[model samples]
Target: MNEDERVELVRLLPPPARPELSADRHRLLRGHLMSELREQPVRVRRGRPGRVVVPALAGGLALALVLTGGGSASGPDRSQAPQATQAPQAQPSAGSAPLNAAPVAAVRLLNQAADAADRAQDTTPRGDQFVYVKSVQTYPSTDEATGEATKGTPQNREIWRSVDGSRWGLLVMDGQRRPTGQDLKDPHARPDEPAPHPLGGGWLEPTPGNTGPSGYAYAAALPTDPDQLLAKLKADTKGQGPGPDQEAFATIGDILREQLVPSPVRAALYRAAARIPGVTVVDEVTDAVGRQGVAVARLDSGGVVETQWIFDRSSFEFLGERTVAVKDDGSWRKGEVTGQTTILGRAVVDQVGDRP
Candidate 1:
């Protein structure tokens, strides 16, 4: 390759990459007799763009930290002032998908999530890693959270942790109207000083008490398989409801026990299912990533006319879960009652320990 060949080849290069080429590129191309050339170093170096590799696991956590972008107050432009939140309005991009895309991975991921949650339930907190929930709350209406939590509908939630062979640490959230009276009794407990911990240990400081409703609802989650999780949730919730008038599920009387997690998302479905007296899964769709899953149910709660989608198989990764709610006026209002949160995240190293 002579100067002539190099020059011609250089002229054909694209701008961003071409700028990196050497003047010698064109000179050598100018003399090229054939399209084919000998393999050699390119004196003019147009370095390839550096690829940014996403770290699969970070901060001693195994689950990849995939940030869900976007989360601004939706609905018609409201006049009320906005409250601060930890996440950005989940931005909807072309890359995003509806709840039903890639059914297989969705199901698997969901199951894995449930499994993780179950494990978090069992994980003993050790080292820096910690299992915890930030907060949870309930709102009578979307606007019910008018910067005043106490005036809003009732909400309740609790948190427990086990670190470094220690006992379960509990943190019961409080409300202005009816404080659970549960306190952080473990004075020996310490916040994570370093990076995230393994086997259930990573407590990002509580999201401040009385921020804006949204107490710990289902927001405080631990890794668990979707199947087991749903089963556990269903089992624990069986015959459970505040009472009769208050309980969002099958009730004993008018007393609501758990703050109508009402599916929290599939709220309508769960709430309706709760009424069915006996709601259970009938079908499911597997999701990608191989570790998650989702399911559909024939809820006997009401007339069995509704479709409830369960997003967890055993582990709670992320899949599809939705529900419909029925108001007191014999009217039907729909909403996503079931959902999840970053309750606990673990990595291979965190659980297995580092090797030398």
Candidate 2:
């Protein structure tokens, strides 16, 4: 079939009653889509015959669902995961300006954060336990037609992750419970085997791996020494994002926000972050929840956006993180808050819906 005919055929398939795709099939389709679009830039806008336009925030949620292997449970047989009380959203600020290239201050602050992490009272979770995290986040959305940027509303998000990478996890957002991963009754099922979804549909059992960024198993297995951890981060995330240092910093932030890590590993992550070039100290910044704090930040390759990890000024505890536009990049204005998050709580829970 010609390329256009193939694309049309794929698009003509009826949408599945339940939104479930096996990991292998999902990867195959994604690769095919990329190959088809390799020579043509796809503009995501309205009224295009062959284009699909997704709202930015909804797209973010969809990505989260895919990564966690969770979406809306469709069948009556599916159980609802327990919902946590939703916290109030705080008004987002414009964020602070980068004062100077204070590497000394940044390194000192990271070391302090690392020290605090080492002294933290953290309990090791068993294989069957789940790691629960609560947070509020906001990301920027752009009008595809006008290319105008606007900040998204702060959203409360909760997630439950499998402790040992063997069980299904859960994500709660907008009052909906989405379970992740296939419920594999046969422990010996291979990645190529078809596993029935708890709701309805066949999903390929995901291969066991330490590559999932949010998996506690992966986090716990990280090198505890700062230098080795940094090197590992670079190696694993090579060729991702705009640059290596930025990608490593962002990966560490992702792990910190979601997974429950051992104290030593957590310390190592922070110390490793300190060694990344272009990282600086921002004296003051506010998280999505409006708590003011200091930050360790790095600018993107274009030097237009600065991603900051906010911390409690007095306690050196991590509050959350934010991304501010450092330069006007046509669509975004300088000092605009592009994205932000405030971590409310994290713990090792007994079940998918249980609170700590």
Candidate 3:
């Protein structure tokens, strides 16, 4: 096959059962390839009508490199990868007064949260199962014509994701249901096209490994050591967002919000988040649903906005997340909430539309 066909073939194949590279190396190599791609021009065939270029080819190539231990003679130094440690057990301060009493240390709260996560029951779903998550969320919508941003009303959202990235999933906003994943059988369909419906419809392509963070296989494969996890997060998200530290924090929040992470991995994520610079604790905060809770927050590199992950005071369970403007940055006033979400529930189910 020619180069174009070779790339396309790789793209169509299922992802490996386990990544060939260690998580840190995989992310680092993938990040480097992406950086190189950004600096170069993407090549497309002259007459290929309907073939969309796949950016995830970077990940594919990275995976191919370290296959069978061909790329690196010696594996990554295990000593340098973050070592797992037993965190101290600490109880949350009693009652509502502690929520308003004083600002607690970020590390203290994260360690407590990690301990709580470690104590939770561990559930590993089968490859055919789905992860269901329900939440209420709101964000500022910018009007294209007027160029003005307005805060939107809260809306209920629900999603079911394939556990092993091999099945079609469903997304429900308000009351409308929409199918996700690409219809692979359509003659003219692109690989990234969305599914038409759930009934007698086209065959859905497997979910791309790079697309969904909440996929069980993906979450289960993450490094369970905080230092290594942080390293991988930084390498994988190198140049995408505002900054590495901020992006790492946001990535951790994303994983925690909707994903059914293994207990050790969940605890590791919390501990990893504690290592990020600029993380702090807010005395009190309310989620989109008006539930009051304490928050672990970090200021953006610009210092104008702060992102917070809220948690129940007594239980240390994650409640939701919100973003607030810390400085008046033309569009928003200080203390104004720019975005918010409250997670109602999450569980593993047998099918696309099934709930917990």
lDDT of 2 by residue, 82-176 (tens): 23445996544675322222544566678778877888998999987888888897887888998787769887777777787666555665454
How much lDDT does each candidate structure score?
0.30, 0.71, 0.72
Q: Report the C-alpha lDDT of model 3 over 112-141, residue by residue, as the tens digit.
A: 788789889977888888888899988889
Candidate 3 has which clashing residue pairs, if any? none
Write down the TM-score for model 1: 0.25
Evaluated against the true structure, the overall lDDT of model 3 is 0.72
**Per-prediction TM-score, please?**
0.25, 0.63, 0.65
Ranking by TM-score: 3, 2, 1
Model 3 worst lDDT run, 10 consecutive residues: 95-104
Q: Choose the strongest candidate by TM-score.
A: 3
Count of steric clashes across candidates, in order? 129, 1, 0
* C-alpha lDDT (0 to 100) for residue 203 of candidate 2: 32
How high is the lDDT of residue 281 in model 1? 32
Worst 10 residues of 2 by lDDT: 47-56
* Tens-digit lDDT track of model 1 for 1-356: 89888767656653321122244644444323111211111121122221111221221121111121112234233233333345765655884432222222222232333234334432333333333333243333433456321223323434433322223233343422221112343555444333333323323233333121122223223113323333444454556643322233222111112211122222222323333333333233332223244443333245323334434544433343233342322223332232222112222123222311
Superposed model 1: Cα runs more than 4 Å off: 1-130, 134-158, 163-168, 172-300, 304-316, 319-322, 326-356
Quality of model 2 by C-alpha lDDT: 0.71
